[model samples]
Target: MKFRFAMVCSSNQNRSMEAHFLLKRQGFDVSSYGTGTHVKLPGPSIREPNVYDFGTPYKQMFDELRRKDPELYKRNGILPMLKRNLSVKLAPQRWQDNAGDGSFDVVFTFEEKVFDMVIEDLHNRYQVLMKTVLVINLEVKDNHEEAAVGAKLTLDLCQKIEAAESWEESIDDIIVGFEKQHRRKLMYSISFY
Candidate 1:
């Protein structure tokens, strides 16, 4: 069976979406979500407001930001990111709200807190189901540059996972091997975090 994957982060706008895009490009079934109360992003200025709700149209948010502060949005790469985010469906959703049908085979989280929240929520709502899911925490920073780095690591992990001949039997070994390989890669400043 093809593995179903989920990528999660605090806001779902940057890190998770980046990985979602890469994985989808690689022909995997994937979804992305946030574990925050609201979507938050950097604004044009210190005083400029930048908060949005889940499921808000990316174009709408982009347009508003562009109207409010075109320079800031453009300089910070928000415009292009927003343009890319527009294609993501079921995004910016809370983890608790998206425990959909227990279909995910694996989930990659960007931080320890998000990983904890997801595991706890899964155990509470789907105790038995949680046993079958592989949740890995890569502790990535929530930023444009960091998100790009994290996407590379996530893509590497997915490629490794996909190449395994027996997913169910070899998942543990795969994770162990991936982590070991990840540490070596990190030594070269690949920055999985």
Candidate 2:
């Protein structure tokens, strides 16, 4: 059976969305979340981000940005990213707000800070269910190119995990080979609920 998976990031608009898009296309059981207090997107200036509440629809963001500056948003890849995100889910969800909804077998975070936040949130939830979830962090830069590459790498790792009879048993070896092949360091934590 396929494991329930989650992809999380600060904004859930780039790195997390990219991975979510890839995982969903593969027919994997997956969801994504943003850890930030508000969903933020790049604006005309670095200081002026287009911020929205966590539950705001991706379609709305796309429409707003398209209306504001279609050419600029398209050039920076924001328009395309939002379009893909809208196709994946209704909105950018906040991880904290999603706690009581359900649990994932594995949670993948694109950055260390996001990983830490997820781990902390899980820890604070307490172990009412006694089920274990593996949280893995693969540092991916928050850029279009990096997100695309990171999503592919995450997909490869998921394929390996899905093939194993017992993921807990083979995870170490799988990770070793993955790290060697990709030449990237991965950080992980185990949390229970």
Winning model by lDDT: 2
How far residue 40's Cα lies from its native spot in candidate 2, in Å, is 0.7
Off by over 4 Å in 1: 45-49, 126-131, 184-193
RMSD of each: 5.1, 1.1
**What are the Cα lDDT values of the candidates?**
0.76, 0.90
* Backbone-clash count (model 2): 0
Q: After superposing candidate 2 on the true structure, give the runs of residues whose Cα lies further than 4 Å from its correct spot.
A: 100-102
lDDT of 1 at 77: 88
For all predicted structures, in order, the TM-scores are: 0.85, 0.97
Give per-residue CA lDDT, model 2, range 89-170, as digits (tens). 9998988999544468889999999999989988888578878898999999999999999999999998988998998888
Q: What is the lDDT of residue 144 in candidate 2?
A: 97
lDDT of 1 by residue, 1-193 (tens): 5788888888746899999988888889998888888888787566754989887777788888889888878888888788788776633677777755677877888888888877777756735443477787887787789888899898888777778887667767766787787772221010110
